[model samples]
Target: MVAVAAALALGTNAGAQLYSTPAEVTANPLVKGFTVSGLTLSQGQTRVTLDLAGGRLVGLLVQGQGAQEVARGLVLAWGGEEKNVADLARSLGAEEVKAQARTAQGFAEDSEGTVLRLKVTGSGNAERWSAYTSLLIHPDSAFPTTANAEGNSKAPNVLRVFSDFQCPYCKRMWDTAHRTWAAQPNVYRVVHYHFPLEQHENAEPAAIASECAAAQGKFWPYADQLFSRVEDWVPQPNPTAKFVEYARALKLNVGTFQKCLTSAAPRTAVRAQYAAGLKVDVRGTPSVYLNGVQMQDYSDAEEAALIRTVTAASPSAAQVIEARLKALR
Candidate 1:
């Protein structure tokens, strides 16, 4: 049996009041195949722990103000694989909860403070087995500010990209998006957010490095270097040295960049961006939002066409004035 400690801290106001306990699992139809084993309400947070027949443990921590959930953390474990879950929870700034018996674990958070439904499935033999944990975070969370954006912020067409440095799909999407954006640089603003998946051990560090480079006005270049050389550093025992090498190559102030890596701010910012992505129901890397609306499964041709449509629909200064005059008529 593996012992795992999951911690989640929701920084509510000092005088925030605790809300009522969450409804029982039976009360929420969205939850299936799990039994609620424990529930607690304290310090403006509600915790629900669930147990499955195969000794799987699932814990949920929620912080709310009045009747609204403002933040939440979901943790799932089976045999002894709580390390990933624990690390993810800590990255998102959640408090710790203890558990035993583990197979594999997953952690997810919500910045919007809304209810989430997840599907948990598992099967095992006498030696070892695995399970699939699905998390559904509500889609009402506010989008985080883009710390690394290319093009004009006030542009009418905006593209928000949620991605992980270690995700191959994200890299593919980046390649496609880069080509498209290069062709129409003034048509849209592209904002990048970090959503590092737990399976990639080096992803978090890469995200931190990108954010650190952003502080020095080189986020795009640093990200390009990291993605271009992902295969080189991902397998290294520690990728920080490689990250430093990239910083030097970018002509960044190495001292300031290295200090940023050790500081909590960059990691914290990455986590916050991840939480925001979850709030908007981002389940995978390369999730894109056009003008605040999620766009799903589009081919590169379709994406380019959509971009052209947005660009065509955008009004020029003279067109804006003409439209205003017509509206006044």
Candidate 2:
């Protein structure tokens, strides 16, 4: 059988608390799983260890006074039972959780404390149930954006791009952006927006999937895998199954990663992003906006010209306002 040793460390004013008792945490009797074996709690820090033998790993760190309290009582506290890994991941912390896939064990931290979920698909498909956790947990940073809340500060031209993981058009535009604007130091700024269609169930899942991976600071790698699967039809079984493969390929904590995807928070976040796109006039995937000016043709020449114009003008906030007003007229 596959064996996993999960460790978590908590910190506070008192110092660090370490939990490592194998008996305190129990593995799922039917299928391999994890439980808190030992716990160390203090006013400043808390720690727990999960002996995940034949189970997937998921984790989170909670900060702040409320999180500290939660961490103190987490081992004794019981949350709702969730079959999906994502739900279990989120239960640890009340934040949105999304699932990712990886081959091995992984860990995460937030406001509450640190958590480690392991994947113990030890020997057979039957043993994989260990990956589906009954416990709860809740689940960062990649790609610097030149655009601020008001829009591009350097480029002044905000390229809001609506993209899909399964769309070839989106891939083409992504490539073109890299060759054109993304290569420049501070020429043009691009803000990507996700708009996975209903026809492509996998596209939305993939978007959430990548976001879940982002929880572990692996957004780009997750994006790369999703984009790589653009040619194929990612459906319930296929996309879900393939995500596990991708996680395995990336050596991610398969259990915790998968749980993140099936959680509510990440799903809500994806939906919120999509709703925000509607307000910005995204009629279709691969939509482009240059300085708030929608680009009808995503051709190289048109995109390049727009880039050159914005870069040369280096429009100020007032100038950008004027330009946008002129377009309205």
Candidate 3:
């Protein structure tokens, strides 16, 4: 592990030090899961840093430049004030917007959560701007989690999908599984798992909020409301508000529901799911695995072929070999 010197926040007049390498930046205690380099903040100054090259913050990269252009754009975006960004901000919720903005252009850590000062550059004068932003990575305790859904007692070969409440692909997969389950009720069991992406800022919180409801014995009802109208909210600017509406639709004790959204344990469990996805190389939504064998695509025909191969201990095993040869050809 690369060692990090205690980093002073940006603008603090703390002693100058060399970061010198990428490994150092990655292992820094102050930095969470983001890239850092090519930027400087004086000691005691706060800023969030990100991997610009990674296309990680494409939404806020200012290809356009003007005096105070970035800062002004941020303020407008932050307050649901800017026409261009407001729709997105409102859809994503103000908190999510701030998270997106703070790390939009790498930020540095300080007494505050990761923060960054917006300044317009490229003009030799290094023109400074005033708009600032902060991104909060809730305490680890705030992530969402799952308590095994009770009826999962159906079978040992069950497959569970902890999916995002707002993801479009999740809906399609749910439908596909529903149809498949109806037909193959004895062959497979489907369980749901929640893995909300960070990019879908509201997703994690909403998932945690739902899981909290689940704790209170309302999870399936809440999930039904979310998935039922998921299509209506797709490509819309604010999926979170729609989720709140779904909560209201379910009459899920609004006060308790909101409290659940902010709860730490639920959030922590949600983050754990995201981390688990990363571990399994799940790059997108609707990823599924069968008995830990990731199911890329197995139609009924393919499944039947495998079942036949397994059940029939043919004396020749020759047909299977010939079939394999034909497939390779």
Among the numbered candidates, top TM-score falls to 1
Each model's TM-score, in the order given? 0.51, 0.46, 0.43
Cα lDDT of model 2 overall? 0.44
Write one digit per residue (lDDT tens) for candidate 2, span 1-329: 00011112211211011121233223322113322334222233233322221221121122113322332233222221223223233343332211211233322221121222322222333322112111111110122231112224476445566678877788777666534656553655666667787777678888887777767767656676777666553544557777778877888888989899789866776776677656554667887655444455656564445333433343422243333223322
Summarize candidate 1's per-residue lDDT along 34-137 as a digit string, tens digits. Answer: 34544533332233333221121122333322111212223222111223444433333322211111212332222221222221123222211111121111
* Whole-structure CA lDDT of model 3: 0.44
Badly placed stretches (over 4 Å) of model 1 are 1-141, 298-329
Off by over 4 Å in 2: 1-157, 232-238, 307-329
Clashes of each: 16, 51, 35
The true-structure Cα RMSD of candidate 2 reads 23.9
lDDT of each: 0.54, 0.44, 0.44
